[model samples]
Target chain A: MGKIFQKPEALADVDTHYCPGCTHGIIHRLVAEVIDELDVRGRTVGIAPVGCAVLAYNYFTFDFQEAAHGRAPAMATGIKRVRPDLMVFTYQGDGDLASIGMSEIVHAANRGEKFTTIFVNNAVYGMTGGQMAPTTMPDQITTTSPAGRDTDEVGMPIKVSELLAALQTPAYIARQTVIRAKYIRKAKQAIKKAFTYQLEGKCFSLVEIVSTCPTNWGMTPIDSIKWAEDTLLPYYQLGEYKTPNGAG
Target chain B: MTHEHLVNRDKCKGCGVCVEACPKNVLALSEDVNAKGYFPAKQARPDDCVFCAICATMCPDVAITIREIADQAPTENKGGK
Candidate 1:
């Protein structure tokens, strides 16, 4: 039979150790494919954050550096500065990026660090047992907010892409999801564009992918994807928030 | 023309899913184990190989690649003659 789907070469030969049906695998594949297409796999250095994807280095064949929680942006900045010739990218989750790392991300964007960031926004802290995050939506239930997130107590969900776009240093920023085929295609394009921006030596570029957590969300894979499409999309609309050339 | 399913013996994890997925009945679990000490998938009939990547697709460890051997210079070519 003709090929339908096959794993990319950028991924290691080991089976993913992530929980089955987690979107982390999909996001990893997309980044790997983009890296392969850019032909920068050898020169690329990815910073894996302190979250569920902390072990992402083992999944991909490229050189990977581990970063502290919410410190990937700063780490990436240093890497790119020291080795400007090497392609630097950071893979961070919502808690790692929008929560404790917010200051680093904001300053990195303000400085135009010329690096790529793949932000996985599952709306909850997957690594820390479903804790509420800065991007967690109102009325959303997490382990810390079992009664559902109350805006009055925790404040509102931060529109990260919009907030980052307000900074002048960012060259590209987009919010996309992988809940369905249509959004998956858009997410891939946004990821590719983020890498392209880095390849062109542009300022900080980020693509926040709205993903699902079936095990943590207490829903099946199908329901988790549906939840992201139904609840998260409305709060985090899909679009290019900022582009240097004014082209998405 | 000939086809061969080249199993990267080092990578196979003794996952029997591939052995159960192959439709041509050409693949079998090897009695000999690999460096990993797993029963690697092996071809029972090299001549009957159709290069179906089903085994590769089912292999979560990505230890398989089916390669097709191009037919050598045609002994008798109907179109050319």
Candidate 2:
């Protein structure tokens, strides 16, 4: 009999430290599956961020470098420049990527780095006890914003994918979600495409995954998914924001 | 042909994400809890399983793995010839 539906080879054997309802585990599995299918685990180097996924290196069975707060893109840039043969990718959260590391990501993309990034935008700052991140939706209630996010006072939330897509440099920027089976499949496809483009030395590729933070959002796992579908999806607008060929 | 869904009880966190994603309604939170004091998901209706593996896909912890067993074929009577 043929084997079907098992753990991906690129993923570590030990259990994850993610929360029960956190989508980080699903995202990690998707990335691992992509790495396994691409056969780039040996040549891949992941940059772990300072956010909730700071320990992402522990989950993946490959060489990983820990970067400072919002500095993954810079670290990845240096690594990829020095060793062009290796596949470098950064696993970052909304707080790390969209906030403090904004300049690094922008400069990296503008320079047209040949690396991929898995941007997990859970809206709130998960590791920092649910603070208001740069990607936090309008009127969203976070620990820092007890009275809900005041867009007028704090300005609008940064749409990282769209922001990056506006640059003149060639890139493959997409926004995807993994709340359900259908979306998970698409997210995996997008992730694989990003890595494939990087392998071909096309351009900078980033897949912004609109994920859910049930614990931080103050909702149950199932309800948090529903919330994300109702609120986050409409705001984030999931799709291929930019491509090298300029085909949506 | 038969298909079996194995749940690694120790790794399960009993989040119920798999239970809700299972189209066949084959999984449910078992009465017994795991080492983490959480009710791990169990196959409540094994007969209705089609081995679609939706539960495994939605599983966050990679605690579930689906396997299939093919039936044996009949042997030909070569002695008579």
**Scored by Cα lDDT, where does model 1 land?**
0.80
RMSD of each: 8.0, 5.6
Off by over 4 Å in 2: A1-3, B70-81
DockQ of each: 0.08, 0.47
**Alpha carbon lDDT at B21, candidate 1:** 60
Q: lDDT, candidate 2, residue A48? A: 98
Q: What is the lDDT of candidate 2?
A: 0.89
Candidate 2 residue lDDT tens string, A1-248: 54478889999988888888789999999999999999999999999999889999899899999999999999999999999999999999999999899999999999998899999999999988999998888999999999999988998888999999998774799999999888999999999999999999998999999998988999988899889999999989989988878947
Instruction: Pull out the clashing pairs in model 1.
Output: none
Which DockQ-derived CAPRI band holds candidate 2?
A: acceptable
Which stretch of 10 consecutive residues in model 1 chain A shows the poorest summed lDDT?
A1-10
